[model samples]
Each structure stands twice: as C-alpha cells, then as structure tokens.
Target: MADLSKDYMSNSADPKNIQDLTTFVQNLMQQMQDKFQQMSDQIITRIDDMGNRIDDLEKNIADLMTQAGVDEHV
Candidate 1:
C-alpha cells in the first residue's frame, strides 16, 4: 500500500520530518532490543533448566550404581 522505503529514505532535513523520523526509528530500535532481550532470557532459562535435569540424572545414575554394588572403577 504505502511506500515505506520511500518514507524511510526521505530526507530528514526538515525539522518536523526529522523529529518524527528520529522518534519512529528510536521506538522501533527499542522494541527490537526488548524482543531480543526477552528471547535471550528465555534461552538462558531453558539452558539452566536442562543443566539441572542433567545433574539430577547423573546423581540418580550414581545412586543406582551404588545400590547395585557396581565397582566405581568399572
């Protein structure tokens, strides 16, 4: 519909147009940064969760080996 590329590439020499474009770009950047931060946080949380699960599994295996009288060296 609207020519977004033209609007973005238009000259920003006019005071009003410059202010508006600056505000728009700043808002867009902030929103993208926020989304990226959220995704990063989620990934970190999932990684931590997986680490905990792996640790639990390791401990459980150790316990099972001890109960079964398996040699630690083996």
Candidate 2:
C-alpha cells in the first residue's frame, strides 16, 4: 500500500505539486457538495410524499365521520 499523505506532503516548495494538491482538494469538495445536494433533494421528496399521505388520511377520516353523522359534542 502506498501512503498518499506522506508523498503529497513534502518539505520542498514545488509550485506544480501545490497546484496539483489544490486541484485535487477542489475536485473532492465539489463531489461532496453534489452528493449532499442529492441527499437533501431526496429527503425533501420523501417528506412531501409523507405529507400527502397524511393529508389523504385526514380527508378520509373527515368524510367517514360526516357520513356517519357524528357530532363533535358526541
């Protein structure tokens, strides 16, 4: 196994090496951000689905109670 950390970090100040490291970090951050956005979108969609189901259930219960002629006092 090669130790990437050891090879990337050097005492010498090489411009090319610094640029390569910076590019690599930038790419990694972009990938992470994209995945986070995807996860957030999925969560929001699921929540919306749940809310729709709850709304349907509420409507069904109200309809049933009205059909049965149940009063709030009773």
Task: Tell me the lDDT of candidate 2.
Answer: 0.86
- Compose the digit string of candidate 2's lDDT tens values, residues 1-74: 25666665552357877788899999999999999999999999999999999999988988888899986456
Expressed as tens digits, the lDDT of each residue in 1-74 for candidate 1 is: 36876666665566889899899999999999999999999999999999999999999999999999997788
Clashes of 1: 0
TM-scores for all candidates: the values are 0.79, 0.76
Separately for all candidates shown, the number of backbone clashes (residues 3 or more apart, or on different chains) is: 0, 0
Which model scores highest in TM-score?
Answer: 1
lDDT score for residue 10 of model 1: 68
Residue 31 displacement in candidate 1 (angstroms): 0.5
Ten residues in a row with the worst lDDT in model 1?
5-14
